[model samples]
Target: MTDRPTDLSSPPTPQPVRRSLLSARKFALMASVVAGLGAGLYGFSPAPDHFNVLSTAAHAQVNNEVRKVAQPVGFADIVERVKPWVISVKVNINEKVAKNDDSAEDSPFQPGSPMERFFRRFGGPDGMPPGLRGGRGGRGAVTGQGSGFFISDDGYAVTNNHVVDGADKVEVTTDDGRTFKAKVIGTDPRTDLALIKVEGGNNFPFAKLAEGKPRIGDWVLAVGNPFGLGGTVTAGIVSASGRDIGNGPYDDFIQIDAPVNKGNSGGPAFDTAGEVMGVNTAIYSPSGGSVGIAFSIPASTVKTVVAQLKDKGSVSRGWIGVQIQPVTQEIADSLGLKKADGALVAEPQADGPAAKAGIQSGDVITGVNDQPVKDARELARTIGGFAPGNSVKLTVIHKGQDKVVNLTLGQLPNTIEAKADVDRGDRGDATRGSDIPRLGLTLAPAGSVAGAGKDGVVVTEVDPKSPAAERGFKEGDVILEVAGKSVASPSEVREVLAAAKTENKNSVLIRVRSGGSSRFVAVPLAKG
Candidate 1:
């Protein structure tokens, strides 16, 4: 009776929540329909080509460009062109051996002896008898093999000097198995290049030397008779230029990676264009086989040396009588130079061209005929490039002053003895001095030290960290001259140092003698 009044005035009764449940089959069917719709949507969706078209197009363009500028896929064409010019050189060397006074039966080390067998078992190939081991001794002809290339149409070929040097007879075999007797036209040992001619052939296939320098990384083909394997071809790229392997005084060489081996020496290294870029000469290998590091005589050097060999039987280089050393930064500082460059004259021969031109020790050769000399080796090469009797203007710095001196170069002697005459001056009274902390040196008269002569001041003590020590000055070194002025006492050295300071110079050039040898050293002045 009160429900109508309570609902109107207070609260109403709560209603029950309603729940709907489906059958398992119907739920599975509904899930399957939803998945099918998702699959169809995904399958019918357009590909991402609209967004990736630019990148794909860019990649395709790059590939097309690469196809146009790629390197040669094969060197077959180059090999075919250059193989005909390559030849195998066989040489017969007639080496004379001194007759042994002892008979084979009397000798303990002769072939078939007990010592020979012992050595053969223990020493490997080196222990075998000279005769049995194919060594060059006794009264028989020794055979050698090398490679070369025809340089001219008349069968003029180029090869290493060592290959045909002192050969009793020389033979050349072409790629087609044609062999001919070759006459050695000339050989230059300095350059290790030789010229030989085959009189029987005319209009023969030949290779042309490239006029331009081969750039590093340029593809190269090495065609030669490696290990007596005729017409063998190997390819690589130029590894470096202007390499020096100390083969000789003129050691400028082109380095390549063309798999050169024993018989490959004296063969031509051709560019991809089939032009001779260099002549293979040496290989750097620890196992006596190819390690990919090889050296070649540059085409420019070959051209010059070959032309000279053909014209004259020898190579003549200009010589100036001076023993030179590189101008180090310390030496340059001591000489008051702006930079450490050029060659420093360590000694001038008494009657040599440099001495005749008044060039003396402690002079820095800065230039030859206005061309800058980089170092001692460059100076040697520049001078050697000139012919004897040619007059060259040398720009030299002496006592911190640049001077031009003209001198006629003399022919280089076959044997040059670079000996410097030490100036053993008269002995003087002993003198003492306290340590000069700036130079980190303690000095005394040379005569004060027992066996030290009196021509200069002896360095008694040297601070290991001083500028003097940094410039290679050491105790027992005798300072013969300071700033080109001879000093016989510590007082003289002090006087020269004071004078250099007065002149506001940063360094002082000193001539030092140690171990019976003398050299010029530039020592920097300690800052105040």
Candidate 2:
């Protein structure tokens, strides 16, 4: 604000004091007023009008600033509507204990006791001392509690998987203080989402999933059982979208700067219209309290996961059997991609869905089922959400050409087990003889080398001017396996070649291990 001068230059001209102070005549006016009063008009100001004008201008400026701020919207109404459905989940975990009893042999609980025989024969009193019980000694249970909220009017509440994990009993308290026993529906550990049914009784007000969902910058309210303190509400904006905090493979969390505490998880974050926008999941704080950095699982994601869990007792996501890595700027430049984007196919597992679909290494997966894949991790999570046998449309860019491939997805292998030979840098359990000979060295048998290290056996020496030498063979070329047999000794290679020669073999499949990596190669046998 501009400083007000003592003179009346800007003051109203009608005031006699303003007229004098503006011209430096106020001093004379004050003396004249004192003389006219005779007793001295002591506290009166001759320049009150000048001060009044400045005061009026300041009031107008303050009112104009007030008009700039839009009226505040209160969350009290939202809390009142949704609080009754948001419950404090108390999980009592009773971990099973192992017990051992140690007592005197004379006691009935002990073996070979006369009292035990008597009780067995004629229902006699136990020989154990009064108030002494026989039971195992070294075990106990630990208990923990957290919160959750109803996702449906039917009392289907969602909470963190950890809250109810290993829980013996789970009880929920409504905002109005009514308690109910809840039964677990299902839990997805990868997503940390748990579904529980409260056996919901009577009419309950459940928050609806937000329409159009929550966008960044939208106002939101976090209602939860904070600090186990029952029904606390805090407010913030949607700070970010799609954050991966490394909690799990499917960690697309919506970040918010709201007040959340220890027990606040499993609660609902309501958008401005009092609709459920997300489930409060985690907070980032060194002190473990509200530092305004919290995250929530988007309601859209939870809705799909929860419904699947309810229908199947577990969620089965699509799995395209291919491991992936993020595309770096270096990799992008090497691939001649203008911008660094899309997931890089690191290693395509053999016999997996991706390989069956002809998805090979060096191909970039741009989209999955028509959805743009942002990163390798997100793509993994997306594919993992589908059932193993569900077919998918994959959009891939190979050699600068975008193509959509339709693949018949197969059931994911329970676990991928792969092979190698020791005859030459190989891995396996069997061996054979080779009739088509290039190197003058004769084949020999190698004992099975199973459960071997990454490094396989190497050829002690190679003949000059031979096909083996032409193919870059040398001394110390470790033989992992030949024809899928684990060869431990050099003689095993002869056994393997001998068998291959019986079929007039043209090629020998060998697994060679060198430099800490195992690779399978088909070595063509040359005519002797």
**Considering every candidate listed, which one attains the maximal lDDT?**
1
What TM-score against the true fold does each predicted structure earn? 0.68, 0.60
Model 2, span 1-528: residue lDDT tens = 364665766654344433333434344445455544753455444464654555465455444544443345578777778778688887654333323233231122224333243223322133321111223222544344466777778888888765676566788888889888888999865666799888647566566776565678988888887766778888899999888776555778899987876677788888877778888866665544467877788887888888888998787776676766676664565455676677877547778778888886667898988998878887877777677777789999886689997776655443324333333435343333232244433232223333334433445456667666665565434666666576665556767777776767766655554433444444556655
Model 1: runs farther than 4 Å from truth? 1-72, 96-141, 418-482, 487-519, 522-528
List model 1 lDDT by residue over 460-511, tens digit each: 7789999888878876778888888889887788889999998988888888
Whole-model lDDT per candidate: 0.76, 0.64
Q: What ranges in model 2 sit over 4 Å off?
A: 1-71, 96-139, 211-213, 399-401, 410-528
**Prediction 1 TM-score vs. true:** 0.68
Model 1's alpha-carbon lDDT is: 0.76
